[model samples]
Target: MLRTGASRLALRSIAGPAARPAAPSFTPPLQWTSRLSSMASRRPQLPPMRQLTPIQGAVLRRAMVGKIDRKAEDRYQHEKLEPHPELVTTTSSVRSAFSEVATPEAPKDVDMMARVKYDFTTIKDTFDLSAVPRQAYLIGLAGVLPYLATSISTVYCAWEINHSVAGYGYFLSAQTAEQLLHFLEPLQVGYGAVILSFLGAIHWGLEFAGYGGNHGYKRYAIGVVAPAVAWPTILMPVEYALITQFMAFTVLYYVDTRAATRGWTPSWYGIYRFVLTFIVGASIVLSLVGRGEVADHIKGIPGAVDRMKNLKDDAQQALSHQEEGIGAQKAADAAKED
Candidate 1:
């Protein structure tokens, strides 16, 4: 205020001719208040404003200036103005899986396929089973049981026969066990043929019903092909028979899927055929593997099995023949001497 008044008086003296009472120095609408400041406690009392000369008033105004604390001002701002609203922090706890086994983490750089142990994608891809009738679905699954049973039984019988012939142990006499093992092979092969024929006959039934539009001999040919392929396998060696049936099942399964795709069979037929064929093929492999030893032994000899019992019997018969010749020679010598 004093600086303003002094500046005004100096301007009035300089422009005495044109100056009117200096219009009150312009005041701003918003007055600044120092909320963080304080006045000095001890101060000199001033004479009345009217009695004071201009110099005295100036001097008194200068003496009255309040001191501001820089530290206090900064502290005030830090406490009040800077932290008007506080920040909030939130945290979440996630639950883990309950299994004891820890999951293996996949490589970040590798594709999903690279992490897989088995390449089963081709077999895994099959049509949905919902389209097949419940009865047919159940029965179709049941059809592979004979293949499964024969395969498993053949392996057990083979092991028993082999062990028995070796004098390791016997479930039955060696002959019985051998017969039993041999018995399983023909059943497996003949059963495979019958199944193949039955599956082909389904196409025949479908054609007769004209479930899909007749395509001349195309469908009939499919029916004939399965039985043709199946029957020849019965005459094959056990190993060859099993391998042939496996291939036949696979090929017919492909055909069945193609028929389904062409709308000749229900959409579910492909999946049904896939399941049955998978089982049958596995069964054939199992049977072939079980008979592997028989295959090895039978080479260069037709239906010949070497066992301890057979060897012993041959040795005993030769010994008796030698003893008889020795007795006959002694008698001839005694006669010649007489």
Candidate 2:
């Protein structure tokens, strides 16, 4: 029993040393700690925003504008804007050129045709109106001059009519001549109106002719001369008889001339004279050769001829009536004496 007790005491002492923990093992978990630290260090960080200073912001804004890129500031800048866009100003050459070509108030001709009659303040509107009398006079003269041939024809016709008829018929012929003369007044007025209108058209046309340059100027000059030369040559016969024809030709000539002076294109042949001459000649021939039937409703020469014949017939009839009355009275006296 003594031995067994001693053994127990030894075992107990050994067991007592084992009862306390060894204060954790001597080494730590190095791999796990290192891995955690590395993970934390490797995580991405955000970049801080860069805010602009107020002064810098204002400078950038100003740089975007055109106010600082002025023409005087840089010739290069000015050239860049030319084909693109630039503000129109009084000094702009392009604008000035456009205005010169477009403005009506600006005169283009060397002589300035609008100034031909001095002092537009008093004359322009009345110029046409005042010209009426002159037109009337010219038309009347034209109509009257052609009547010479008609007058001879009329006297011959009248003498024949009187021989065939008597006194009252002669009186009728005289009255007809007076009536026809009265009708001529309106014809004169009509011719005057045409001339006045033509003059006005030509005046305005010349004002626009300057855009054609030197070649255009030459073209215009020739165009104006063409009509002027043509109408007068063509209307020679008409001017001698029908004032209306003269007036029409004159007006057309004036318009063509005016347009030509203004740098307008001329028609083919450059002359209307042949046209007028042909028209007048044809009309005169028709009246003189076609009998009084052709004279009927025909203006100018034909009408004039008809009027002359009527007048002659009236005079002859009156003379015939007087002769008849004298012969009858003498016959009655002789019969009473027998």
Best by TM-score: 1
Model 2 C-alpha lDDT per residue in residues 202-320, reported as the tens digit of each score = 43454465433444444445435434544443333323434444445555555554544555533311133223334444433433343343233334443444566878999999999
For model 1, how does the per-residue alpha-carbon lDDT over 205-303 read when each residue is reduced to its tens digit?
899888878775989998899899988877666667778888888889999989989999877888888878888888888887777755543332112
Among all candidates shown, the one with the greatest lDDT: 1
Cα deviation at 199, candidate 1, in Å, is 1.2
lDDT of candidates 1 onward, in order: 0.70, 0.44
Stretches off by above 4 angstroms in model 2 are 1-302
TM-score (C-alpha) between model 1 and the true structure: 0.50
TM-score of each candidate? 0.50, 0.22
Q: Give candidate 1's root-mean-square deviation (CA, Å).
A: 23.0
Alpha carbon lDDT at 4, candidate 1:
51
Worst 10 residues of 2 by lDDT: 43-52
lDDT value, residue 332 of candidate 2: 100
Worst 10 residues of 1 by lDDT: 86-95
